[model samples]
Target: MAEKPAWLKPHGRPWTRGPGRVVFENPWIEVTEFDAVAPTGRPAHYGLVGFKNHAIAVLPIHDDGCVTLVGQNRLPFADYSWEIPEGGGPLAVDPLDGARRELAEETGLEADHWREVLQAQLSNSVTDELAFGFIATGLRQAAGGHQMDATEDLAIARPPFREALRAALDGHLKDVLTLAMLLRAYHMAREGALPAALARAMLG
Candidate 1:
């Protein structure tokens, strides 16, 4: 018997509803309108909806191999959640520039080295958004507090490599992006593909 190619398999649920973007304010993305048809063949109208947009996130590795985490206030949950340093605001910031800025703003550390790690798409039934993730190692302490905005009063934590991974597994680090990068960084560091500090932290 012949097996199908991995790509041939459906990766997501079949769209039962068809919602088309009715109006577009921005070319990259826009408020969308959807016509969701029911299983019984009845069609329904879905009005305006806020669309998702591209974003960049960083899992910063310090000189000692620890991953830097920021505790910040998230209005959605009305409480602070531990996530990777992230934010290009509501708009797209230059990829590298935004990654750099986020590293500094959230962690008060400047990276001497960085590289793009992964590019992923978040697909919902209605919309999909691209997210860029980066691996930042070789961190240097900043002279002043991280430049934080009103939504980002954060405190930085540098946890040991294994400790961080354990935290992530234990739900202390529940941020999806952070978990993705940590596992990626872990493999890279284990193979000595990462900078010395990162490798050391991963082994610890």
Candidate 2:
């Protein structure tokens, strides 16, 4: 585990975990049931979900301020979700390399510029699923079209950046990584981190 940054002061007492037993195991995730002592000194039973890969998300923004969106049916929630291109890469691999692969495989797009915008712990309460989000610009079509997974049936679209951001705010798109990346881009544009004309196109 990585150490916490030295700048911040420590707070309350931390929870101490005890012996654990595996309740479930799979290629993607593992659930371990453990006995722990909470910060309040109370005994608690907890189930920790561990992931085998890091989630990599890519927001492919075109020079014209258009963004690539992929829609697919998510079985867990039994709903169709529209999101930026995302997939999993092994924990031992570089996230940027994973992001590049995900972008090409899902949208058949290559980006000349890549900026990592966000790192988050998704559902940290029970799971340690960490995610990395990137902004990919200067986009162009890949030599071959998308090579979707055998089980994937993605619906692809290119909507203006503003419209996509609006969809996320309106609850039409609720993927965590997608929401964070879009808002990050908006902040970047407002702060002049992006080119003026490109920012204008996105803000429009």
Candidate 3:
């Protein structure tokens, strides 16, 4: 086996993992509780929620600098949420495909261009949920309208990208993936990573 990179090498003593078991499990997630000996020689108990699928989010931007958003009642919070088109992709499946499906299902939109923008862990301390985000441009409405899940009652909106950014900054859009993707889009626009005209329109 190849030697590990310097950064990957352990700097000091590592935590010692003790006994662990699954406390609860469902189609989407599994909860595990474990005991551990910390590097500082302290004993700790931890509970972690492990996700079965990768989270995927897509920001669909039209030529007019408008973006699609979806609003739905989220079960965990028991409140209505406004977020970019998002869903879960099985860990074995390609996340980009999931992003495309979610965009179409939630907003009836498709894009000619796609770029992977972000990958991250959601709530690292509590869950092992991983997320992937993408930016999709050159968008057009699909011939058929949205085909949402039976449990979904989604509201769709097409607002200028600037407006959406403002909403996110003002805390109206609270979804972590949505906020992160929007901020990344803004960074790309300002950094000239996006098309000049589109960036100008988005920042306006």
lDDT (0 to 1) per candidate = 0.73, 0.94, 0.91
Point out the higher-scoring one by TM-score: 1 or 2. Answer: 2
The list of candidate 1 runs beyond 4 A from truth reads: 1-30, 36-53, 89-93, 142-145
- lDDT of model number 1: 0.73
Worst-scoring 10-residue span by lDDT in model 3: 9-18
- Model 3 whole-model lDDT (C-alpha atoms): 0.91
Which lDDT value does model 3 have at 172? 95
lDDT of 2: 0.94
Pairs in steric clash, model 1: 19-34
| Model 3 alpha-carbon drift over 4 Å, by segment | 1-12
lDDT tens digits, residue span 1-204, model 1 = 379888887654443658476576664456667887655567767554444445789988766767788887677568668778876534445678888877777778887788898787655544555678898877787777478877556777778777888788898777788888888788888887776655865786
What TM-score would every model get versus the actual structure? 0.74, 0.94, 0.91
lDDT of 2 at 64: 88
Q: Which candidate leads in TM-score? A: 2
Clash number for model 2? 0
lDDT of 2 by residue, 1-204 (tens): 377788777778998999999999999999999999999999999999999999999999898899999999999999999999999999999999999999999999999999998899999999999999999989999998798889999999999999999999999998988999999999999999988998998988
- The true-structure Cα RMSD of candidate 1 reads 5.0
Ranking by lDDT: 2, 3, 1
